[model samples]
Target: MYDIAVVGGGPAGLSAAVQARARNKSVLLVSGDVRDNPLYRTERVDNYLGFYNRSGRELLEAFRSHADAMGVQLREGRVLNILPVGDTFYLSIGSEVEQARAVVLATGVARGRKFPGEAEYLGRGVSYCATCDGMLYRNREVVVVGRAADAPHEANYLRELGCKVTYVSAQPPEGLRPDIPFVKGNRVEIQGGRNVEAVRVDRATIPCEGVFILRSSMAPDDLMTGLELENGYIRTGRDGATAIPGVFAAGDCTGVPLQVSKAVGEGQVAGHRAAEYCDAQQREEKTEDKERM
Candidate 1:
């Protein structure tokens, strides 16, 4: 298990990992493909300290190189789910599950609006991670509304579980199984009673027992079910503390000025607090064990 798992690979995430590593803590920086980061689209960064109008990509490379030099373990995979179990956080990264004592969410921000009825039927018949909930729909039909590169892989997981999978998206999914029906649509909606019954993509309706909605980045509320969010951003303090213990958030995902310097500062604070929290928890556990003796 890692001392901490820092999600996302942007400036905020990179800073968090680097700081945690500096504390001599083993950190697993769980990030998806770098292309998914909105920062990749930025052509130039002029305001960040110590950098003179360098391109965003250049800055990202520097951040990555720094982390690498620190020997931080970087895992290039999307965090499908983060479940708090006892004193540790269990993260689902594709098919593999890893555990960490603390978690830092720096996943930038949620980019798109949720589909109609998606939130209302979240657990009933909708899910975000196929690996987490695919077995529940064994022998059933499911629709995967994918907005990420891994959508097809998720569909395949559902199919492997004896479920009929239909991929719904604006463009044909790459690496998708030929047997799985692909429906091209710009807009999609989930309609059902008690459970998901069908998905309507534009004018076409495809019946299904479940719907798996995958996005490049999940909304803060959806990322951690009970975590507090204010107007779509994770509500965090200057220390990056959230409502949940052992969990923290930083960067644009937290809200506003949306600047690289702001993200870096918040990440540093979060990394430091997370290290302290973990150290304190360990000390308490040791004390309790000693008392038992």
Candidate 2:
């Protein structure tokens, strides 16, 4: 178990990991492909404090190098869920589960708005995690609305379960199963009656039993089932503290200017606070053991 688990490998996440390590706490940094971050698409960033007219790629590389030099353990995967198990948090990452005393969410806001009828039909026929719900649709038709790198894999997972999976996206997804039927729709909507009945893409309608909306980053509220959210952003204080005791949030996921500077500062505070929280939990547990003795 790590003392702190920092999600997202962008500037904020890296900063958090580095700071937590500086506090002598064991840190685990979980992230997907760095390029998946919208920041990587930026042509150039000119307003950063130290760097002037630096390409996003260059700045990101620097951030990564610094984290690596600091001995931060980086794990590559998207976090599916965060559950509070007693004093620690259990993070479902891709296919693995990791335990951490404290967690810092730096997942940037690549989360898009829900499709029409999507929320209304959730659980009845809609899902955010294909892996979590794919088995239920075995041998049945399903539509996957993918906007992240893992969409193709989720589609394939569904197909392996004997699901007749049709993938819908604005553009062709990388690493998608070539055999799965692909639909290119810039704007797709869900149509259902009691349960999901069809997916409308432009003028075409494809019937399906379920629809899955997959994104690069899980929304904060979705990641931590009962976490508080304000206007779709994780509700956080200046120190990145959240309603959940051990779970803190920083970066674009917290809201506002969405600048690297703000993220870095928030990360520093979050990491420090998380380290302190973990240390306190450790001390309390030790005291309890002593009392028992």
Candidate 3:
């Protein structure tokens, strides 16, 4: 188990990880594919303090390098959920689970709203992870909603698992298996009664038993229940502490101005606070053990 887990690989998250490591705490930095990060595509970033005129990719690489040099463990995957049990926060990363004493959320803004029946059937017949639920739909029909860059690869994995996969997205998918049929549509809706029956992709309604809605990041509230939000952004204090104890937030997820400098500064505060929290928890546990003896 790590002392702190920072979700996101952006400027804020990298900063948080670096700060936590500075406190001599073990840090785990979880993030999706680096290519999916909006900053990675930015051609020029003109405003981040000392680094003027550098491409976003260059800035991000520098941040990542600093974190790596500080001994922060990096994992590539989308965090599907965060469940707090007692003093530990259990993060479900795709099909795997990681445990941490404190969590720092830096997930950038989650684009788009939920589909018609997306939330209602979340666990019933809808899923966000292909690796986590692919075997359940083997030999059964399922619709793969390609929203993230890696969605097509995930859809391909499902097809290999014997699932009759149909790929749907706003634009045509690159690297999709030729045998897997692709549907072009942006306005999609999920339809079902007891379970998922079909996915309505604009004008077309394709019958399916399951639907996988893949996106770059899950909203802060969706990641963990009881995490408060203000005006669609995570509610946080100046120190980046959220309503949930031992859980802090920073960067675009907290609010806007949405600048790289803001993210990095907030991340530093969150990381430092999280490290302190973990130390306090360990101290309390030690005290309790002594009392028991």
Per lDDT, the best of the predicted structures is: 3
Stretches of model 2 off by over 4 angstroms after superposition:
none
Global local distance difference test of model 3? 0.95
- Indicate which candidate wins on TM-score: 3
CA lDDT of every candidate: 0.88, 0.88, 0.95
What clash pairs does model 1 have? Answer: none
Ranking according to lDDT, highest score first? 3, 1, 2
Give the better candidate number (1 or 3) by TM-score: 3
lDDT (tens digit, per residue) of candidate 1 on 63-119: 999999998898887787789988989988867999999999999978889899898
What is every candidate's alpha-carbon RMSD to the true fold?
2.8, 2.3, 0.9
TM-scores of all models? 0.85, 0.89, 0.98
| 1-293: candidate 2 lDDT, tens digit per residue | 99999999988899899999999999999998776887787899998998999988898888888988888999878788899989989999865799999999999985677778977898899987766777889999999998877778889989888999999998888888888999998788899888999999988899999998877787777778778888888898888899999999899999988999988889999999999999899999999999999
Task: Kindly indicate the candidate among 2 and 3 with the higher lDDT.
Answer: 3
The Cα error of candidate 1 at residue 75, in Å, is 2.0
Off by over 4 Å in 3: none
**lDDT at 288 for candidate 1?**
95
Model 1 regions more than 4 Å off? 94-96, 133-141, 156-164, 171-181
lDDT by residue for model 3 (108-208), tens? 99999999999999999999999999999999999999889989999999999999999999999899999999999999999999999999999999999
